[model samples]
Target chain A: MNNHVILDVQNLKKYFQVGKNLTLKAVDDVSFQLHEGETLGLVGESGCGKTTCGRTCLGLYSRTDGKVLYKGQDVHLMKGAEKFAFKKEAQMIFQDPYASLNPRMTVSDIVAEGIDIHKLAANKKERDEKIFHYLNLVGLNKEHANRFVHEFSGGQRQRIGIARALAVEPKFMVLDEPISALDVSIQAQIVNLLIKLQKEMGLTYLFVAHDLSMVKHISDRVAVMYLGSMVEITTSEELYENPLHPYTKALLSAIPIPDPDVELQREQTRIKLEGDVPSPINPAPGCRFKGRCKYAKAICSEQTPQLKDMGNGHCVACHLYNQ
Target chain B: MSKLLEVKNLRVSYHTYAGEVQSVRGVTFDVEEGEAIAIVGESGCGKSVTAKSIMGLIKTPPGEIKAGSEILYRGENILNYDKKQMSHYRGGESAIIFQDALAALNPTMTVGKQIVENLMMHRKTIMVDGKEVKLTKRLAMQEAVKMLKMVGIPNAEQRAKQYPHEYSGGMRQRAMIAIAFACQPKLLIADEPTTALDVTIQAQIMDLIKDLQKQLNTSVILITHDLGVVANVAKRIVVMYSGNIVERGNARDIFYHPKHPYTCALLEAVPRLDLKNKQELASIEGTPPDLLAPPKGCPFSTRCKYCMEICCEQAPAATDFGDGHEAACWLHHPLAPKDDVPFKTEVRHE
Candidate 1:
């Protein structure tokens, strides 16, 4: 991990109108920074707006407020050549392999889509060479190039997706739950492939996933989201070992340990959250997790807690540490 | 404990245009009166087929349960049951819950109505107001509210009246569990029940299921691909691969002293949060075998690090270690060389 910040997201918000008067707060006041060659994991439950945050950061969805600075330039304000260069500098690997790629397109065309759009290759041979190079980089061979997308398995299709993302030679990539849809054995394979590629290409990643163990394994830092708001952010080790927020503690404790011995010997109190997450539409001005938190007090419902920096760069947005 | 359900020599095949796809082959297992047995494997390993066969849920013509298979439930062969008898056994004696609660539930009707219908189908009479009465819709609705509250659904009276689409994901799953357990079935089969929920919600649902199982003494057969879930909830685990049972053991034995190479690879592949040192996950080399024309030998032979000549020549028999732990691998054979431990990928240095 380097000190150079590749992407700086400040107070980003994305809202959707569900009805005539309702506003669904998808990504509200989320902020983070992705350093060069560093993997920053964004973790939350299904409706926690982690994916929306990632999409908003990558300019896939226009931000309702705040700014997304990609190397000190506002992504929302870029135009013409600057926008094209930004597209080349940033890419995304989608979550679903089955739905992301077109079944009619061959693997070669899919991998070369970015290359063709950017016209990185001077001749047909150079394009073919680049396609084969990315395929090999993602553990696929030149033989797999001519085959259609439907002919490949889930893991193979994901590799094709990676190859497509890498074909652009992007400096920053947003991988939105890249391995969540895969099987366990295949998940490790994909993770290893990503690690190998990151090391070789010096790519920075904003990996969004629901799997905590996988996030801890691959990320230098992690941020926990709940109901469209970031609850905690810190180094992966410190976040896992000494989580500050009650929601993070509950989430970490809820993860089932694979070892029987550890599971059997675990005597810690299970922080069972009481109710489901409150609806994000017209949410109250308070902690989003207050309804389910065990230690919530009167002040928690009166005002929203801000993400405050503790020592050693650990940050938490909870009323427990307000003093 | 007496056996509640026993499946013997169970072979199921699907007929397609290409050939007969052997989805499940000679699967044998038994669930004790109150035991929780988990059948764990990746997709297409036939764990779901086995679970569906137990409930007589497999669709024939395209799929068929082969001859000489016996599915004995409570000392009676349910495989030969007629339609009416099968229906009676399905919800009254045994029930299955699915992962996707919305898909499994009736969307048009209120959740309470669904539970009441199930209860009325399985139950004949209920005691109401200190008198024995024929189970009426009103009485059944009362019971449904009780069931809803039992599953930890808050505001059960109001929530029970809403349709399935109105409830959240975790709540819908809880409602499904309430419906499944409404009949008080002797056996419950949960097919990846928590796979669709978040971790915290998954933990809550698992705890609820365990509590209900203990309270009702209902035998459970949990089919999942997650070994971590199995370790935490299940007592006995049967690891399957390409329609074959590769290993069966108690949770402790399976996790700590795995015998099969596939099991070892699976254990090593999972990233553990308890470990102090972070290391790269060691994954198995290839995908599961294609069931259309599965290998004549061991199904995992193609990816086994300990693959030998005989592994491809013939299928290995299940070698029983003590305490009901068994593994089907050439390494466990008596004639195989000793000191040949199952190999795992080396931990990464950097």
Candidate 2:
């Protein structure tokens, strides 16, 4: 219960009952803490439950079990007003800007929606001011406020999404692959804008993405997830420099280097994972990665490994590292 | 080295209500037999247009091939070919794999039927023992299964019966690849095939493309914005900006020692795993200029960090920068007067 800890999730579990008795463990036993004014990057491949985890954390989807502690308070146990206050404190930025924003609503209405719901604005003028303020913060001009979502470009729409998230004056935001839908040239602009806003507003973020390079660039600490579990978590530099988990290593190796000379000269020993990822419904006993892991042993299939700290705040979950 | 496909000064424009939007301007490049070439640029940079032009897929009326456009496939002018001739060239000589697998594929038809259709249409008719025999449906189905297996789609026989919607995004892309490779075309044009896929799936598709190209000995034209995706895949790189080929060279030369200012900016703009600390990513300010009235000088001059006065007034001719590396910029022009101004230090990222 540290004040520095803006949001802390303990053993979060979200399971969907597929059949009469079977359950699909979308997010099982996932734990992480987002500190004040810091970005925690959650990265994994598609269907790895990163999106589910983010949505569940935002209270959009209720967690089947476990606790989401916000500023030392249990969010699940909070009553009407308390939950409403928590909603104001934490906001989410969705992946697709075009779909996330209502097409019928103008930029002003879209951004001011949160403000209207929370009644944060004193009057119409104040609501307009707040909308423009957040818009300017995200690098959008006043003229863009009147335009609809369809009129703006992808990057601009994402900015409006960010502005909508910030309209509530949230201390922490869940950025779920915000830049993935944007162009490469515009990605840098958005990232920089996020950094500037974080610095100015003292905002904390849970930045989820599949792009390892961009995640490493923006995040203070990084967590690697695979098949509904946190496989590794460490400082951004440490995670990229010395990845401990086998899955993490494979994922990093698969990233194509931009420099062709370095790409060619570098021995690309791709750890070709055999077969597709196993289904989440009734997952096999022991390690989830045992099927694809090259170094997996009999012990790996028999017992699941817990995330253990290697050193210097680097935590990895693997039987190979346990020895 | 024989050139498999050569495009010279390709100019494609779309007739819009506002004006004629010139999509591609004087794009020239060559793909050697069995070599992979990449056209790298941002959206609206004419990379896709260049690929569409090569495939003769550019829709006319709105899109018209202006003068000074030449597309040579195996030393023959494909532009001059009629629709029937182009159809023969399409699935038989060269194939294109588009970005959206779901959109490109026929959702109602089973993957097997789709592949079989291409095979039946393109597979050369043969005679056995002085007796002509048409290809049977069974033979086409067998070839379709073979194509699926070649692209590494497991349980090909069963999966082939399933429609495109049943297949995952990666599998659909693989199926698209199967269709493209059914006839074993000499040249393959993959226009951002991995853009819609996840990184892992993207890697898989890229690997499949590379492996197939090697096995078939087919040249590839990879058009994409992701620099990393094209890093090891392409032998040569052509950097495009505002409908013009700004720089062209071997992949190694372009990545290691980029000559054009736009190329250098693009390389620096991309976030890399190797870069430590949040150094300012070099972003080219402003969007690409409108192609209808493209600037007289370098197309990138408006946003160029090293823009000179001469660059704004007159177009910089293509200048060779050793070892087949060339760039179109006033800085490289010998006759242009040198400026004392240094490159702009506008830090893009924090």
Listed models, DockQ each: 0.78, 0.62
**Relative to the true structure, how large is the alpha-carbon lDDT of every model?**
0.91, 0.87
Per-residue lDDT tens digits of candidate 1, residues B228-290?
887877899999999999999898888878888999999888888878677678988788888
Off by over 4 Å in 2: A1-3, A18-22, A123-125, B125-134, B291-297, B335-350
TM-score of 1: 0.98
Q: List the residue pairs that clash in candidate 1.
A: none
Candidate 1 Cα deviation (angstroms), residue B271:
0.5
Candidate 2 per-residue lDDT, tens place, A1-323, comes to 12488888999999999899898999989999888999999999888899999988887888999888889888778889999999999999999988999999999999999999999999989988898899988888899899888888788889999999999999999999999998788888888888888888889999999999999988999999988999999989998889999999888877888977677665456665545667888898789999889898999989989999888879898999887
> What is the Cα-based lDDT of residue B3 in candidate 1?
93
Question: What would the TM-score be for candidate 2 when compared with the true structure?
Answer: 0.93
Candidate achieving the largest TM-score: 1
